[model samples]
Target: MKFTRRLFLGLAALLLGVGATMAHAANALDTIKQRKKILVAVDIGGPPYGMIDEQARQVGSDVEAARLLAQDLGVTLQIVPVSGPNRVPFLLSRKADVVMASFSITEDRKKVIDFSEPYGVVPVVIGGPASAKVASFADLSGKTIAVTRGTTSDQELTRGSKGIPSVSIVRYEDDATTNTAVATGQQDYIAAPPSTILAVKKASPSRDIASKFAMKAYPYGIGVRKNEPELKAWLDGWVKTNLKNGKLDEIYKRYFGMSLPPEVLQ
Candidate 1:
């Protein structure tokens, strides 16, 4: 009888220990609320999404969205500049509470970080002068195309040009360089992101530069650490609420000069 009683007591103690561990497990929501600030990682080089403004400040649509998110949470927003390759790493290392660096949702990326539902969309399109004879991807059989190295636009255009003969590709380090190549006729066309391309087109209103065709589109999402279910749920709902309420649209239009595209809504 004494042995049985001791065993029961040990079992109770084990259960209590398990309960304590569960209760004390780290939770991003609790921590964020307690700290009163959410550190958002962003890249200042990704134009329209994140970039330097005329005042030489790191500002972009993504930065503004982060601001709105902080406002919704009634917390302070702390911006941490990160490069494309390091955004995910920053989140995993707890260097940032969230990442809003135009992080595009992809199947491969899902294996690493949790993405909030898409907050914005940017299309990858081939743009050029309207006077250019190119009508389709096939039409660019032997023509030169400009793209930033390591972008979806570069990957897709390169993949599509596999069998096409004499399809020259010029890879630049940045979107501005690609745009300049097109503007100077050093490149016949530029396969680039929607926002940067739009800004370029707007800059040269009489040049007839326009989106010739789409290569791909990406719905950008806010990123958080994996296993933070509460944080993920809250972030997703926050994005959905703002998007549905037209608040996200207002921010987009304020930066990019148009409402969110219908494709983005889908």
Candidate 2:
């Protein structure tokens, strides 16, 4: 019965996808021009990618990227705070024009939404206080590690621990809290990107937290509804121009303290 139900749902989804694609001739560029604003979904709970700054303003790499995209489009920017569960939903419901929420370009997600060329890259890894002794994923055998709920870190960590019964993955509501658990010794380590670990270091500068082993990396892309060819083309072009002109490099240096690596400039 479970297998039958699963098959039914999969078939339904496939049909819906076909229908959406067949009906995808709508002009996203026209709608944006008429609205005069681009509604961007951003995950602000993760520092460096998105966060509330000292001035109580929303700031981060993703946020700044959205701002630049809007600027180039000659439109106002409207930010909508979104989490993993809501990112695609809000975008599909028309509450968001695009998502710049540090969303990774993945094959699974590509089934639902089209992604622009990658604008950034995140090196995924396990890091903790130097004393944790996590040298690799297998080294985490019985370690207590934290990961943000519903994030790529969480998904990857869960999938990687299929046979490691002693591995305890502690899930947190937000990336900040997940990293905090490691910094404060509540957990042995955290599955996070190097950039996130760097942000954690800024708060606890005295702590000696270093990378253990890297998992698959994430490439940041702008998400658009699957059928929005015009919007997708424009976003890809925008990325190309910014990469050539160095606006993205400026954004990266402001927060990460250095220019973005050549590999991520796509």
Q: After superposition, how far is residue 242 of candidate 1 from its true place, in Å?
A: 1.2
- Model 1: per-residue lDDT, tens digit, 17-62? 9998786567888889999998999877777888887898878899
> How well is each residue in 184-240 modelled by candidate 2, as lDDT tens digits?
778758888887787777777777777778888888899999878899999999988
RMSD over all Cα atoms, model 1: 3.8
The models' CA-based lDDT, in order, is 0.82, 0.84
Off by over 4 Å in 2: 1-25, 205-207, 264-266
Off by over 4 Å in 1: 1-25, 170-188, 201-209, 262-266
Q: Model 1: clashing residue pairs?
A: none
Q: How far in Å is the alpha carbon of 119 misplaced in model 1?
A: 1.8
Q: Deviation in angstroms for 185 in model 2?
A: 3.4
